[model samples]
Structures are given as C-alpha cells and as structure tokens.
Target chain A: MVDDEELTPLHPNHVKVLRVVTALATLPFVIVALVLEVRAFLFPGAFMVPVVLAALYVVLRIPLRRYHARGYQMGEDRLRVVKGLLFRSDTVVPFGRVQHIDVDQGPLERAYGLATLTVHTAGTHNASVTLPGLANETAMEMREAIRAHIRRDTM
Target chain B: MDSTAPTPQRTNPLGMIALAAQGLGKSALPLVAAMFGLRDEFSGIALVLVALAGVGGIMAVLAFLRWHRLTYVVGAEDIRVESGIISRAARSVPYERIQDVSLEQTLLPRLLGLVEVRFETGAGGKDELKLAYLTAEEGARLREVIRERREEEAVAGVAQEAGAEQDSPPIFAMGPGRLLRFGLFEFSLAAVAVMGGLAQQFDFILPFDIWDWEHWMELVAGPGDWIAHLGPWAQALGIMLALASLAVLGFATGIIRTFTREWGFRLDRTPKGFRRQRGLFTRTDVVMPAHRVQAVQVGTRFLRRRFGWHSLKFVSLAQDAGKASHVVAPFAKLAEIDPIIRAAGFEPESDTLDWHRAAPEYRTDSMVLVGGFFVLLALGLGIFVNPLLGFAPVALGMALVLGEQVSWQFLLHATDARQLYSRRGWLVPKSTIASRVKLHSAEISQGPLAQRRGYATLLLGLAGGTLALRGLPVERARALRAAVVESMTGTDFSELR
Candidate 1:
C-alpha cells in the first residue's frame, strides 16, 4: 500500500498556467496602484511600487516551489498528499469517510494535460482536499482507485 | 386489517373556505396593494384594482376547489393523495419515506373543528404533501392508526432483538409534563420575531426620522413633563414594559413553535425507523432510520444552558431539509440525554480523551492582514487628505478585529472507532462534524504568506455542503487527515511526516 504511486506529477505547462492565472488576477490591483503611484509622482507624494513588486514576487514564487514539491500516494486505506514550499504537509483521505469525488479541469488545465481531484466527507465540509495540477492519465487512475475503495467500503 | 372497524367521517367546509382565502392572500396581496397605491392615476387604475380583486376572488375559488379535490387513500404500504385541477397530479408517499405526520389546527381551523395534516418527507421542501380541512377527530384517529401500525412494527423488532440479546424496548414515550416543559422553554425564534417587529415600528436610523428631531423629542417627552422627571414611576414603568413585551413576544412565539413542533407530537418505535409528529396550522410528520444517522449534535443556547436543556439534532440524509427530525427536550440535564442517545442507537458519551485544543493558525494572521489593509487605507486617507478622519476610527476597527481573532479556538476529539469530533466557534460557536463515510475530499492549502507561518487549512466536503477551516496548524491538520483517511478505507496509515 505504501509503495502504490496513485499520483503522478502534473505537466509543467499546466503548473505554469495556474501561476499565470493567479498573477493575472492581481493585475487590476497592480494597475490601480500604478495609477496611484503616477498621480503621486506628479504631485510629489508617497507611492507603493515597492510593496506591489514585493507582493507579485511572493505570489509567483510560492506556487512554483509547491508544484515542484507536490505529490500524492494512494493506499487501500488512505489517500496521502505531500505538498509545501518550506513547511511540507501530507494529507490522507480514507475510503470510509469519502462521500464522493469530483474530477475537474479548466480550459488551461485541459491544454496542459492536468486535472484536479476533489473529495467530500460528512461531518466537516472541509474534510476533502483538491490536488490540482495532476497529470490527466494519473488523475483518471486515481479516480478509479478512489471509486473502487468507495464501493467496497460502503458495502 | 382495521378496515372492518367503524371510522369517523367529517369535513370542515368553512375551514376549507378559509384556506382558500389564505391562498388568495398569498398570491393577490401585492397586486391589491400596488393597485391601491396607484388609485389616483389615470382612471384605468380603478380598472386595475377591480381586475386584481377579481383575480384574488378567482384564486380563492380555485383554492377551495383544490381543497375539495384532495383525497387520501391509505394502503398497507403507502398513502396516496390524488389532486390538482387541470394537470391532475398524484403524490404516492411510501410509509417508509415519511419523516413525520403533523396534525395542525390554526385559530380558524380550531374554531371550525378542523385540522390540517401535513406529510413531511425525507428530502427537501418540494417533497412535502398536505391534506387540509379534515375534522380534528378524524385527524386524531388517523394519527392513532399510523401510530398503531408503527407500534406493531416496534413489537416485532423487539421480539427479534430479544431473541438475540434480551434488550429493552427501542422507543421511549414523553410524559405530558415533559411536553409542556419543552413547549415553554424553546423560545429563541419568538424572541427574534418580537425584536424584528419592534425594529420596524421604531426606525430611528431612517434619514427621514433622524431629521424629524422635534417629532422624536415630542414623542419621547410626551405633552408637558420631561420623561426623566417621573423617577420611580419611570423605573417601574421600564421594568413592567420590558416584562410585558417579552411575555407577549414569548407567548406568541411559544404557541406557534409548539403548534408546529409539538402538534400531534408523537414518538414511535418501528421495525425499520423512528418517527416524530408536530405542527399547528400545518402538521409535519417525519421518520428516519437509526443506521443512517451520520452525526449527532446536542446543542444548548444561553437560555437553555441555565436549565440544562438540550436539543438533539441528527445529521441524517433522509430528513435533510427544514428543521429535520429533531427532538427538542427541555430539562435534558445530563441524565436524560443517555436514553435519547440510546434511542438514536448511538453511544451518547464521546470515547476519546479530551486532546489538547487545536488553535487556528490563520486567526491572528488573517485579522492582522485584513485589518492592517483596511487600517492602511484609512491611514493613507488621514495622512493625505483629512486629519479629521483621525487614527481613532482605524484603531478601534483594528482592535475589534484582533479581539475576534484572538477568541477563535478549535477542539479535536477522536473515538476508538473512526469517529472524529472537531468543534470551533467564537461569539456563536458551532460544532464541526465529519463522519467516517461522509468525507469526500480533503486538501491542505497554503499560499506565500501562510507557508511562512507554518500553517495550512483543511477543506472538508459533506453530503449537503462544504466548509474550509483556515489557519490551522499544518502538522496537526495533516495528522487528523491521515487518521480520517485510514479509518475510511480500513487501512493502516501513517501521518504525512
């Protein structure tokens, strides 16, 4: 069970696109800040270019490191997750508690051979985790394993 | 078969007429009010109002027709209601699927000697069925007939269980005193309704009212003497006013809640499930299988905390809508809960040792980041534009956010079996639940800032919904996740160290 590699690395391009989308979301805020800075320059006042740059750097760097380090291991008993930038974390989801599973991909993910897995549990709405940016074939295989576990455990 | 026995037969035509009137009020009141407000417009406004009145009258006629059209034929396995005028629809509710049966008698129905029966199904609001305008006696007899059938099933179940372990009976009956006590004590809904009514009458914050300072002062001070001058009388008046308001509010609320929740209230044991009945104007009957209870929550509010009363709520799929199938027993001091727990077929007491409190990781960080951002905006405005805006407002807002953040605390407990209990809340605390079977997914999330703080959040998904626990100790959250996954698949699992 420990040796079973249910999760395979996601496509690098998919990981890149995810980070790009995140950075693009912050673009409007950056534009607003830049406009404010230009206004401040004309008026000889305080500007926030340094803060904006620092935020952009942090946003791109974290996901890059996380994608590089991220991996998942599936056993008959639990679904294990290994992910983190500096502080690593491993999450396990057992078959008995998993209410259902969702496999999803956005247009970007589809272009890059990546998919995400979402699991649900009963007591806490937040029990399940989504392992985004998984290789498409690996995500399909993992989905099958989770489904098989659900059928056997439910009986 | 009970078919040979004589059955009472009577219907309330007047009550049926009233139901039609109520149905019309629901559909036509807005139209009537709109036309009334436009009465001064082109003489066509009068024609509009007349048209609306005619429509409302037609609705009343239709409602009565529908009421007369409804007919229920109870079979050994199910009860079917065949009604609906143009597109005739039939609702066939199997006995097993019924969550509860309520016999409700509104003020009008009570006067007319009629009761409205409501059949609450396991699913959402759309599944519920209603049969109105039956005589009260007929309603009671029908309820008894259902109860007797359930009892026979219970006896059969007990005999089977007795063959195995000689266990006690599965059902417990509440005494009349207990019912009355439950009715008197559960009154939060009533308190809220009264507060809403008072807020509407005195809209002090309305810009128009704020401008009418003289009118407010006159109303407050009355004709001559200022309000403060009547010292002792003022104090007495204040006390009496508060009590009178609460009493009227409580009475109105208690009666309504009791009518819906305790009307024809019955607790029955059956071979397949447990049943509860309650309602006033429209009774709701409910049932749920014992094995399907995913989680149990025993909750007490500030009011009930003093009296040690608890309301037991079940996380069951069958009855997932409205109030679900809950037992609100007042005076449920620790001793009373044991039987209720047993009745639920689950051990009442938690098995795990009270582990260390799991503090939320993002509590301080989130409050500081979000509060700091807002404070920065305010400070920027103050520095660049208006010094009059002052640091005091921002300071107060930051303090409030920090105060709330500091109070967030989570406790995690695990049973010898796969059961895990996680409860966290501040101000109005709530219990976080996860059963072994309901966990569909879990993820440990962190961004640039959260990673630095050595924290992550776990997102859990349940049958009806999802919740995200943010700013949790990453290591502990990981360990908890592993335990949940292990229990779920029945495999030996280790923490993600």
Candidate 2:
C-alpha cells in the first residue's frame, strides 16, 4: 500500500451504498432459494449454510473490507486506481490515452452529494475505470483536470 | 438549451420520417395480427387507414421533438453534442481523440438518399457517436473533414517525432486467382457446423436411423438387394466412402462461400491511407488511416503455418461490423503480410526474426491451463458415467500439455522504434504488434498457479483490444508494469518508442 502514497480513499458513505446495492442484488436469488428450500427433494437444509455464508459475506464482510481496500490517485498526467484486498489490482491510465472523462452521479450518490469519475480509454479490458464515492465537487474537479490534460496533450 | 452554444448542427428533417417509419414497422405486425384476430370493424379499409394515419402522425411528432432537442456542434478542436428530451447531457470529444468518422448508408438511409455518420472514439463500451440521418453530401463532407484533420495530425506527428512521413505506394492488390487461393486455404467449417447443429436440433435432416443396423441396411441397400449380396466389409467400406464424400462436400461448400465474399477483393494504398474493397454484392470499401490503426495482428493455424501462410487483422476503432477486426490482411503468405505491417507505419527491427523468447514458466502455465481444462472435462465424464474413457482423455491431455510446453519455445516478444510485439500459441499461433503510442493502460494479475510459479500475467490494454502475456517473473512483471506507467508519462504521443 506504501508503494507511492498518492492513494485517496473513497467516502465513508460508499459503505452504505455498497450494502444497499448488494442487498438488492441478492434479494431475488434469496427469495427463489427460500421457496426452493421448502420443496427441495434431495437434502432439505443443504442450501442453508451456503446461502447464509454468501449473504453474510455480501452484506457484511465484502462491503466493509472492500470499501477500506479501495483507493484512487489522480495525477496531472495519469490516474491510478488500487482495488481488491485478496485479489489486489493496481490500474494506471494515462491522460493522453483517455478518450473522454465523465462525472456521473446516481440517485443514491445524488442524495449524498457524491459522484464517480469514469475515465474511458481505447482499451477493451479495464477501458472505463470508474473511481466511485468522491465528493460531487471533487469528481467535477477531477473531470476538469483530466479533460484539461487531455486537451493539452491533444494540442 | 443555451442560446450561446456555438455551431449547433442537426440531422436531416427526413430522419424524422424515417424514425416514424421504423416505429411503425416494429408495431405493425402485432397490430395487424390483433386487428384481424379480434376486431371485425377495424378490418374496414377506411378505419384501418385512419388508425394508421393517427399512429404515424404521433410518431412523426415524437421524432420531430427528439430531433429538435438534439444538436451536435463541430468546434475548433472538439465535436460537442447536446442531447436528451427531458434530461440534458453534453458530450465533447476532442478531434485528437476521434479515431475515424465513417459514413454508412443502409437500405432505408440509402433509399432516402441520406447517410449515417458515426464517430468512433477509441473508448470502451459506448464508443460510437452516431448522427442517424444526414444528406449524402453532408455525410461525405463530415467524413472528408475528419480525414483531412487526421491526415494533418499524422503529418504533424511524424514531423515532431523526427520520423520521415513515408507513405508506401500501392504495394499489392489481390488478383482473382490470388483471391481464389486465399479462399481455398481458409479452413472455415462454419457452414458444416451450422448444418450439424440444425441436424441435431431437427433429427429429420439425418435421413437414416444412426443406431439401428436394419435401418442402416435399408439405407445402404434394400433387404435382399445388391448391397445385401455384398459382404459386411463392403458395407463398412461404403459407409467410409459416404463419410469421405460428406467431408469433400463440406470443404467445397466452405470454398464457395469464401469465393462469394472475396469475389471482388482488393487491397491498395490511397494517398493518405490504406483502402480495402471487397464483397461481391454489398461492395464494401473501407479507408483506414495509418494513425487510426491501434494494432496489427498476424495469425495462422498449425497446418497453414507449415506452409508459410497466415491471416492479418488490424485492431481499429472503426465500426465496420463483420469487417473491422477480420481486416488488414484476411489470409495471405507471410511474404505478403510483411508489407502491410510496414505500410501501417510500424516496422519491426528485423522483419523475419529477432523475437525475444518468453520465460520458462510460460510452458508450465500453458500446460496447467489448457491441459487442466481437458482433464476437468475428463473428470466430469468419469464421475457421471465411464471411468475407462477417462484414462484415455487424461493421457491425451498430458500429451497435449507436453506439446504446449514445447510451444513455449516459440513464444516471443519484440519491440522496435514504434511498436511492441508478442507472438505465442501453437494450435493457432498469432503475432500481435501495437504502436507504443496506442497503449493506454496495463495490469499485472496472478492466479493461484501463477502465485506458486512465482510469475504474473501482464495485460497490456491498447485501443479496442487487450494483450495478455502470461508467466513473466514477478519482479520483471512489476518492473514492466512500473516502466509502462512511467513511459506513458515520460513519452509524448510522437515519441512513443
């Protein structure tokens, strides 16, 4: 983590966002599994442990660990995003290669005055690297800075 | 919405009519079906006409509103688009980032004497900016302007980079004979695969009962007929002959399909770019500028590689569907492929060789991955039904894994003044070369096996594609990743090398 300390942590509210998104995403499958559990012919309680473990991981462990683990750095000419605790990935994108930059806010983000900055490049894998849970103003400033770099590089 | 916005542009008014027509077509089938099935009074000519007119008018109005709301402006250095009916959004793509502006005219647009102008930005996902309908002349004008700008940039790029602007003249064109040879060499089993899939889906396609011996006997010869007079060995020989004929038929069909597509195939150099004209009936003509090209890939099957034959493709941002990635060189001799690579302004240090071999770990990784996949299949089958056949698959997998280990001897990487190269694989070995300038992002990933082997997979992401190089030593991978990131900052667009 101390390779270079330009890393910026996401907002604390991001944990709440992650939890809600995970709960909503898992809701449908859990409901279906609950119904299936009653009629299941083979082992009646076979799914219970796996289901509970997955739910606990999704709702509790993941959002907490992941939120703390994720950090991004915005330089004048490049952006570095460090993510994942167990399967760690450090992604760096140059401004010259960035085709465009956008500051996007969803309804939840809007409520918290938070936004995510997505930097798009020509790359297929890791093309649109999104840095979520920045202050709305910070996201806009980052977008402008990246855009400025892009414009300057083009010229 | 702002009046101060400069140089606002809109699609042709006829686009509204076309949009309405499209909407009508989508709903027409269901509307017609329900009207006939349920309503007697609606079947009247006057009533149907009135209803149709009403729907069409509403559609036309909606299209007009959308047209009115959307506007794109060609700025000094950016193309700014403002759109959306209820919620407004403005997107500005700088001219430098614009890969290509292509003009497409499908049936409706062509019939209307209009065109669709698409701007390909070398970005992920929603990479295309489309202006649905414009007058043919307007579309052409936009395309020409973008091309001119790109040409200027290329010249400027070359001049600033201290490289001479060398535009190689018309190198080679595929004659009909050459095209025929190219077509024949391409081992496309898509046709046979489709037929086989359909046969399995609908068993009636298979004329004879495959399992029943009596049914097969009837197919070969009626009971007490001439084939029955022949021995069982003769019947087996007849079946072998039938299989051979089927194989021959599949091969011939594939050849014919290739000929149809490459009938008028032509590749020649234009003043500022490369021009590829092919297709028998559709007659596609694609113009690829040198700078717009992200990477060059040369591929060849194991059999074709023995004969010095290979296929080449250009990874570009152009939305030339079906033709986009399968381009640069469809199928040709390695001798023929070299010039195209050079023509694209990427000349490797040594044309024929000087490829850096991969680390020894590559062999071990390839063995584990490919062989592991096969062994997993074997294990699955063993658990389900047969244990005896599982041993054979496992043995075969081991042999194949050994072959893959040998293939690592051929795994190579190279870098020249302009590009980075990676050549790997044995079954369908491919050589990939990308301009150093085109590299945007990169990552290092390690799986459980890689972690144990003390190596990591390096993924270099360019415009429109990603190249993954596995089994690099952990330290080397880290160094390469850092170097890549450093080079991205250290070098300017012109000084890619």
Q: Per-residue lDDT for B1-497 in model 1, tens only?
A: 25334332224566667676677668666666666676776258565857576667777788777766666676666677788777778778877556556666566666677777766664556668867778877776665565545556433445433122113343444555666666676554556666677767777766566446798778767853564687888868878998887876776676557556555555555543565545555444455656555566666676655676656666654443354435533235657656666665566555444543534556767677768777887888799889867576687777768675655544344434545555554433444344554455556767777788777766654444444555667676676655555555553111100
Looking at model 1 chain B, report the run of 10 residues with the lowest lDDT sum: B488-497
Q: Which candidate comes out best when scored by DockQ?
A: 2
Which segments of candidate 2 are over 4 A away from where they belong? A1-68, A104-115, A133-141, A152-155, B1-169, B187-224, B230-237, B322-326, B349-390, B447-453, B490-497
DockQ of each: 0.26, 0.31
- For all candidates in order, the CA lDDT equals 0.61, 0.72
Taking all chains together, each candidate's TM-score versus the true structure is: 0.63, 0.67
Q: What's model 1's lDDT at A75? A: 66
Cα lDDT for residue B488, candidate 1: 50
